[model samples]
Target: MQRVYISDTNIWIDFGQAGLLDALFELPFTFVSTDIVVDELNNPAPAGLLERGLVVETLAEEAVEQLFTLMAEHGNSSLADVSCYLIAKMQGLPLLTGDGRLRKQAAKDGVQVHGALWLLDQLVAHDIVTKAHAAAALQTMLDAGARLPPVDCAHRLAAWRT
Candidate 1:
C-alpha cells in the first residue's frame, strides 16, 4: 500500500531548493499540499508542484475547526503549518515536516511525522537513490540554507563523503 502524506512548506522548500523535487515522485508515497502552503511559496501557483501531481487541498468543514485547535496549541506555527497538521491528523496520514516544533508536537499527539532525513533514508532503502547520491542531496540541501536536523549531521555527512 502506498503511504500518503501532507507535506509542509519547509519540506517542499528543502526538496525544491536542492533541485531534487522530482526525487520525491520516485518514492512510494503520495504528497498533498494545502492552498496556504502554495501561497507561502516564493512563486505564485508553482507549476512544478502541480505538474508533479501533488494534490492541492483546501480545508473542508470541520477541518477548519481542527486547524484552529491546532493553531491554538501550536501557536508558534504558521497557518500553512497548522493546516498541514490538520490534514494529516484528520486523514490519519503521515505529516511531512522539517519543523522541529511541529515534529515534536505531532509525535506527542501520536501523529506520524517525517522529515528530510527520513525521506533520504527511504530513498536509499528503496534503492531509488544510492547512499552516495542521497548524501550529496543532503549536502545540496544544506548548502541551499536548509536547516536539517542536527543530530546526525556530522555522522551522515561523513558517511556521505566516503
Candidate 2:
C-alpha cells in the first residue's frame, strides 16, 4: 500500500473545510506526519487543523533522515514541508499540499503532490458534495485568501458542473 503524507499547513486548512480527511481513510494509503510538522502545528499561529485530533503523527528516525536529504537536495525553506517531501520521495509516497512554493519545489524535486484542486476533484467524483457546493466552497477558499487563479477556478467549476 502507498502512503500519503502531508506537510504542516496547507492540506489541513483545505481539507478541514472540504471534509477530505474522512475520505482519506478509505484510500489504500497510510497518512503520516513528521516531528517537524508536529511542532509547526503545535504553534499558535498557523493552528494546524489536523492537530485538533483528526490523525496520528509518526516520528520515525528514518523518515526524519529522508526529509533532511530532500531539504539538502532542494534548498527548501520550511523544515516541515521539506520533511514531508523527503518522506514521500524516499518511500515512493504522494504528498498532499496547497502551498504554491512547496508545490513548485516538490515538482522540481520529482515528488508527487496533490493540492486543494485535487481534493475538489475527489469531492465531485465521489459525490461527496454537489458541483455547486464544491464551487461555493472553492470560492469561499478564494475569498478566504487562497491564491487560486480565477481562470483555473472557472475551468474547474465548469468541468464539475458538466
Candidate 3:
C-alpha cells in the first residue's frame, strides 16, 4: 500500500461504520480527505476520523482552477470524486474509492485508485486484523449498506476465515 492515500466517501464510511477506521491508522500511510468530502461524510464521524489521524485538507488554490477545467470538460463528473481526484493528482497520491464510476474516471485521467477490499486485505496481511476479524468486518460493512468489492469480491471476503 502507498504511504499516503486520498480516501473517497464510500470507503471512509465503510471503515468508519465497520469500526475499522482505526486500522487504517495502524498502517504506515496516512489517509487524507478534502474538506468537501469530509462534509459529505455526514457529521460526527468526520470529527472522529480527524481525531484518529485522518488528515482533512482543503484543495490547493491552483486546484480550484484545475477542478473548474475538469468540470467544464466532464459535465457529469461528481464534485465529491473530483475533489478527491484533484487532491490525489496534485499530491501524487493514490485515491481510495469504492465507487466504480469514480475509479473508472480516475483511471481515465491517469490517477491511481484502490478500494475497501484492498484495505481489508492489507489489514489481514499486516496482522492489523486477523482473517476472522477481517471477514467479520466485511460482513459488517455489507450489512451496514456498503455496496463494495463489486459483488465479485464476495468469494474473497467469504474465504477470509479459511
- Candidate with maximal lDDT: 1
Clashing pairs in 3: none
Residue-by-residue lDDT tens digits, candidate 1, 48-143: 888988888998877777777777788678779989987887788899998777888899989999888888888878888887888888888888
In angstroms, give how far residue 78 of model 2 lies from its true place: 1.8
Candidate 3 displacement at residue 105 in angstroms: 1.6
Error of 3 at 9 (Å): 1.0
Instruction: Write one digit per residue (lDDT tens) for candidate 2, span 27-117.
Output: 4445576656666663222343344333445657776666666566656447777767666666776787765676787787787888778
TM-score of structure candidate 1: 0.90
Q: Top TM-score: which candidate number? A: 1
How would the candidate models be sorted by lDDT, starting from the highest?
1, 3, 2
Tell me the whole-model lDDT of each prediction, alpha carbons only.
0.83, 0.64, 0.80
Cα-based lDDT at residue 42, candidate 3: 71
Q: What TM-score goes with each of the models? A: 0.90, 0.69, 0.86
Output the better candidate (2/3) by TM-score: 3
Q: lDDT per residue, candidate 3, 26-145, as tens digits?
A: 987888888888888773377888888888888767876687777666565566767887888778889998777667878887888888888888888889989888888888888988
Greater-TM-score candidate between 1 and 3: 1
